[model samples]
Target: MTTPPSPPNPKAIIFDLLTGLLDSWTLWDASTPTGTSLEGRKWRKQYLEVTFGSTVYGPGSTYEELVARSAGESGLPNSAPEALLQNWKDLTAWPEVGRVLRALREKGYLLGVVTNCSKKLGHAAVRNAEKAAEGAGEGTWKFDAAVTAEETGWYKPAVQAYHGILPLLGEGVRPEDVLFVAGSAGDVVGATKAGFRVVWNNHVGLERKGDVLPLREGKSLDEALRDFL
Candidate 1:
């Protein structure tokens, strides 16, 4: 069956939904052995082990499930603890990213942040984005809505994550009206499947294969927006 065309001007907003879309490599890079890349995942596993004290595996055994189990186990006061927030807040924007987003926002588009990061990390990233936007002389970029995986109870590649945010948008918005920006192929696929206008921010020059071609592609946030707008 043929797919319908996307709406030209959506009542809804644009979403930069994840660490990749908000923060640059510094926040997500796991090259440092103790960083989230290597240690973050392990930390989550161990945290869950200590908290749950049992091998609690959910469907797909995905990172999102593990994080949920850990949060349930930690019983930590905040949705995201200080340690995680400190680690995540250190992220910065890629070259011209702030400028591009500001340009889009000035065009009267509502900007939102939907991320798979735990609530703490997601909020931290948003704070960083606000700082970057300020530095760019754009004033603080306030998100129309910021939805984290913790709140949604699902992760990217799962339809629920996208569906969960639909109600938060303005009335009369449909999936196609949203521009879902993602750097990872999996995110691109997931957003596309959810009926969004997928914008792949391929910063690292990763190989693209089947299905990757159908969506919009950009090497940086600036490049993506240039084509998108």
Candidate 2:
């Protein structure tokens, strides 16, 4: 006897907007290193590790301000932090990202963008994406809803953030029925524990850790999402 076909998609897919969908690492990499010494590089890396989440979700803190703080703490050149902020404000989505997002929308997925950023920057990222697509003639892109941690008062890797905001996005949607896309290990772990199936968007071949694997992992956004597509 033949088996019945499965449904075409989940109830929705939530994106970890910045690093996950926007490829922040690529841009981060192009910046001049803060220092040449091994200790200095290590220190800068540590600063990034903290700044990525804390600055966004911290009460009254924005990415730009916290990044400058990180630069100072990391002992970087004076000009570095503002340059980083400008790069951030000018962020654009990756080539083909808009097309994929459009495809997902057409496929009937209720899309969401969750980011640890100020409300202004979170929305700015979406608008930036729209501009990027238009400038590249890639086509328009939009999401059904967006959540910023600054508004919610929580950050990723914390279960409260996911469990709290999801209901607001799609009432009655179960975590098991939600798909989350993320690039960082903290994000992967948080999403898994929150009960959403995760796409570990490991676009740079970062070594996977522990045994609790993502529902999928890949070197490109398209590859990480192939299963759903």
Candidate 3:
């Protein structure tokens, strides 16, 4: 078993939107029929990996379409999937997330968020983290940059998406200098392919398959780094 890597004194930390920062699974867990606790959210993640790229529809679709389809596929039809999309704005950082971010900021690491949402929704999600962080007395969640597929017209795990985000991370930040925080297997592989070091935010005990290695992994961002200290 390859252990997670220690941070190479990262210049910035770029977080994945859906699973990295917010708790999107709870929403799925609330529904998911047949057998009562089959974990429909896992299906949703796999669905995203498929739909975010070339599938039946070709290339990809918007966040709205993705959510609606995932909901419908997971037995949440007539569940107002679009309403769930808006619910992102109401999400707070997962437990200890704000504290971990504050610690990184104290060390002068710039922070960012990368998502496959529109310009409008992506920024709103950032505000969601900002609210949660500050309310936790961890200071405001300030990001040095934010990127969305809607803004760049490319979903993640694709070189184009990472390229779109790299330049926005700030003046001197290099692809090698930024630490990409991955919430899923696709994220880990994608960011690695993009030549960025990575940290796996494995909050849900998701398996780490394939050859892509991460800098670290932990239930919470804080606990992950403890190995290095």
Best-fitting candidate, measured by lDDT?
3
Q: Could you tally the backbone clashes for each prediction?
A: 1, 0, 1
lDDT of 3 by residue, 93-169 (tens): 78776666676677787888888676777788777776667776743467778888777777887767776877887
Q: Roughly what TM-score does model 2 have, to 2 decimal places?
A: 0.79
**Per-model TM-score versus the true fold:** 0.70, 0.79, 0.84
State in Å the error of residue 225, model 2.
0.7
lDDT tens readout by residue for model 1, 1-229: 2222544764454455443455444443342244444544434434424322222223544444454445445443234334444455556767666676677777877677766556765677777776667777844566677776667766665777776777777676678778777666666666777887766777765455444442456777766555455
Off by over 4 Å in 1: 1-7, 11-13, 17-19, 28-31, 34-86, 209-214
Stretches of candidate 3 exceeding 4 Å from the true structure: 1-7, 31-39, 51-60, 138-140, 227-229
Score each candidate by Cα lDDT: 0.58, 0.67, 0.69
Of 2 and 3, which scores higher on lDDT? 3
Q: RMSD of each candidate?
A: 7.0, 5.3, 3.3
210 in model 2: Cα distance from truth in Å?
Answer: 4.0
Q: How do all the candidates rank in terms of TM-score, highest first?
A: 3, 2, 1
Instruction: Indicate the residue-level lDDT of 154 in model 3.
Output: 77
